[model samples]
Target: MRTTLSRRSLIAAGASLLAAPALAQSGYPNRQIRIIVAFAPGGATDILGRIVADHLSKAWNTQVIVDNKTGAGGNLGSDLVAKAPPDGYTLLLGTVGSAVTNQFLYKNMPFDSATAFTNVALVGEVANVLAVHPSVPAKTVQEYVALAKSKPGQINYGSPAIGGTGHLAMEYLQSLTGMKVEHIVYRGSSLVLQDLLAGNIPSTMDNLPAYIPHINTGKLRALGVSSAKRWFAMPDVPTIAEQGVPGYDAAPWWYVSGPAGLPPDITKKLSDEIVKGVSSPEVDKRIKDAGCAP
Candidate 1:
């Protein structure tokens, strides 16, 4: 014979389950929250961080500040947040370079990607554009590939850094096209863009926001975008896959995370707020205008 639980017992069990999340949520983020951007100001990461901080500040009625700590291909800033107190006050605006692919590229990383932090929320992804200086004779993707094939090692391309997403994406393109081209690594995007505009480097893959304005003014010509589909902002631009190379999708993503072992309540609260911020129409429009499909 089976018997149902008494009302008192059932009520107690339900209350216990509810209490756990409530306890986890309490006493979290009692002070200002600091978001660490692993790159310098004027970059995509810094811009996204500021937007998130502003939205969160208004929503939570608490101070949220973005701190730019740039170095070591984003390892310096990421490591700082990884080692910070597990309290909810400290957070990281982690990117694909710092969070997902850094381990594969760097040999002596300070923090272990597996245990350093918990993934809170994915902020968004940014598409990259393959752009060339006006001096290049290529007018379209087909023309560029043909020119590279004919020139072989004579054609050069610049990237923000060696083994960065831009570099790897171009390498993937090379593997597909079976074309040989020289690679030029710059310390940062600013240097890469400056050289590209000055006609020092003929071609480079960079974030769309950084190249879109120049592409519009005819300073640089966009060959294609590095995404699965055409961007909403640049509807006319074809994706690399559509142009020639098949299955060539590469983009950098931004995510929010805190140190490992954060209380479950605090985690939920933070994630909830981030989802809210990213879902806002204003934020969505800003992201779209940046030539990235959020």
Candidate 2:
């Protein structure tokens, strides 16, 4: 099973909200097209981006590359795509932050997400897992919360980006439980995972896919998942709501988009190809193996 929430369900939930305005362009992607992944390589976003790129490359007989542009909580890369020509040659594998949440999280946004780009396709959703290094004593979500409450701001947790879903999920958890922990934000999930594995950081609430192997290998201990219910890939792990906090859900979605002014014809082509690419047998298994719903 891919997820409790299916791909169609996620599309239904997010597509309308991300619909973009119409404009001009033609011939679609005749040359090499670039898909900008605004996070470091090896994270869920980057992995999914490459999956899309590979599929598109074969399907369209064009070279599709994934560029990792990391900075400013994904705004740097997002802004780059926003400012690029709306010819469908340059695209973005956008996360929740780059698409929606960063506007509210940041004081000054370089581009207006409202009109910057056209939403090509809603990729899928992934739950952020709240995991800690073995050094931490906490074994469950309640224990982790109690530890944080006792230490207050002393406990530090690493997140992929400032306004990204991982960061926001942690913020949401703190708000619901009144637990205080210092935030150690990184440019991407790989860097955060690096620090966490080396025991440089004690805990993290980040995308579950990147941490799954370590969690299974005993390098990390998963306290709880940030989704509303148990994740299909990690059903043994409980949700935060089940552990202690009720009604806690912070799953994040991914999508493909290009700059605004893309002609309706080009936009439809891109969206159709993306949806088809992700649904292919190979890509679908890859997404599910990455612990995301496809």
Candidate 3:
């Protein structure tokens, strides 16, 4: 996912943080820090939130908590942060929808996703894979498209939310492949994945974190990843662009942020810590194993 933090800026931020003076003479983060995750547990954003919280906890020598605040197409939790004090103790690990595309979808948006918070760091992104239950006979994306064409609108797929990247990715697939499939929206990835695993839904598209283990266990078959290139964790699976749809890429990115009035130094401190943590080799491997990019 693209962001204001370019590669060079990220590298410089990390180096600057390490040598910078200890956060505030009063000792910032004297108490626990809370990272608000706008979805239920087990989604990509939740998993990444936990990872970041763990790192920040260790780095600042304070307890960092992941508070799951799910509701209103992700507006509830996000609004909580938007209204929270800008002392930097309360952070938000908002996804692409909450931080970027949500403003265009919801009629009564609580806050301007673009301006309500201070964009701190790029927390990394994960590919969304088009997956089907094992019962589906189609193995590749082309085969799946052919099958869908045969059945047309009868075939249904699950998405995390109505205007989420997963839903839009599948919609984009429909336009590219010329297949008309039904879409069912869910509040979160866990439930959608649960139904898919139970064979209640024939197919679905979700972030790589929630679906990779099932795919690895052969419970779900990955038709194609939505990234431009095959993800590192699933190197054997071809991307949709490679399969047939050229230039098809819609991976959802995550970013860390605080309320709109957060101090610049506080934002930089958080961003620096996150960049350093994400750049570490051990954390990189862990992120890959979680089916994400760091």
Candidate 4:
């Protein structure tokens, strides 16, 4: 049997073919999406990831989960997202180290930070506070630098981990000021704060979220904030740049990313959702409450 197709039917077929990609991306959240955190739970990275995931779940009416894949100084989780399918389901909540600096420090990387992931959206910006325990007797960054020089390796300063922004920030300060101090590495901010509160570590350049309360309480003397400008949460506090290290800026940050090669439509959709999640008035207040700049 021979059947003639209507001209309208042929036009409809062509339209369907043209709409395939756009349709696929527009209906995106038909399934769950997962954001992989490169560090363990309770750190600034984890906190910001969870905040973004929560807002995304609401925005998309689909579940969004945070999976912690800690190890290799945040490389393991980052590599997983880098190699995942570009369907936009799997994303990495990576930090400055994972997305930018780790390649220079590590010899064998599973994926190139610059090429393996598409920069989705920035999640949060945290000023690392250069703080010393109340007993340290340091009132300013210059004094702290002088103290470190006098004590050298005997003065212990802690960071979340090796190669983390906190560690690198302190190292950069050392390089600029010619100050030498022992570096203490912890698994995450919580553990580092534990030791810091106990007076086991004398000083740290840790994220502001974990140390802000102590700084306000006078338990730790905040010598300077690592941001180029003073952080909003503590407007009275000075930045390291203003304090003495001119032009110094090593603030910790987190960003959303997905495997490279994602379809442009889906990438844009995801980026819009992420930007909304972190920048909305409600979320912005929450991020600042957590002692970060969204």
lDDT of every predicted structure (CA atoms): 0.77, 0.86, 0.84, 0.81
- Which of 1 and 2 is ahead in TM-score? 2
- TM-scores, each model vs. reference: 0.87, 0.92, 0.92, 0.90
In candidate 2, stretches whose alpha carbon ends up further than 4 angstroms from where it belongs are 1-26
Write model 2 residue lDDT over 1-294, tens digit each, in one string.
123223554543344443346423445577999999999999999999998999999998999999999999999999999999988899999887877788888898999997999777878789999999999999999999999999999999999888878788888889999999999988778889999999999999899999999999999999999889899999999999897799898998888888988766677778777788777888889899989987
lDDT of 4 at 252: 70
Model 4: how far residue 268 lies from native, Å:
1.4
Give the clashing residue pairs of candidate 4, or none.
none
Give the RMSD in angstroms, all C-alphas superposed, for model 1: 8.6
Alpha carbon deviation, residue 82, candidate 1 (Å)? 1.3
What's the true lDDT of residue 20 in model 1? 50
For candidate 4, give the lDDT of residue 42.
80
Please provide, for model 3 over 85-191, each residue's C-alpha lDDT reduced to its tens digit, 9 standing for 90 to 100.
Answer: 99988989877778666787888999997688876777778899999998999999999999999998999999877877788889889988899999998889999
**Alpha-carbon RMSD, each predicted model:** 8.6, 3.9, 2.6, 10.7
For model 3 the TM-score comes to 0.92
Higher-lDDT candidate among 2 and 4? 2
| Candidate 4 accuracy as lDDT | 0.81
Pick by lDDT: 3 or 4, better one: 3
Evaluated against the true structure, the overall lDDT of model 1 is 0.77
Where in model 3 is the C-alpha error above 4 Å?
A: 1-26
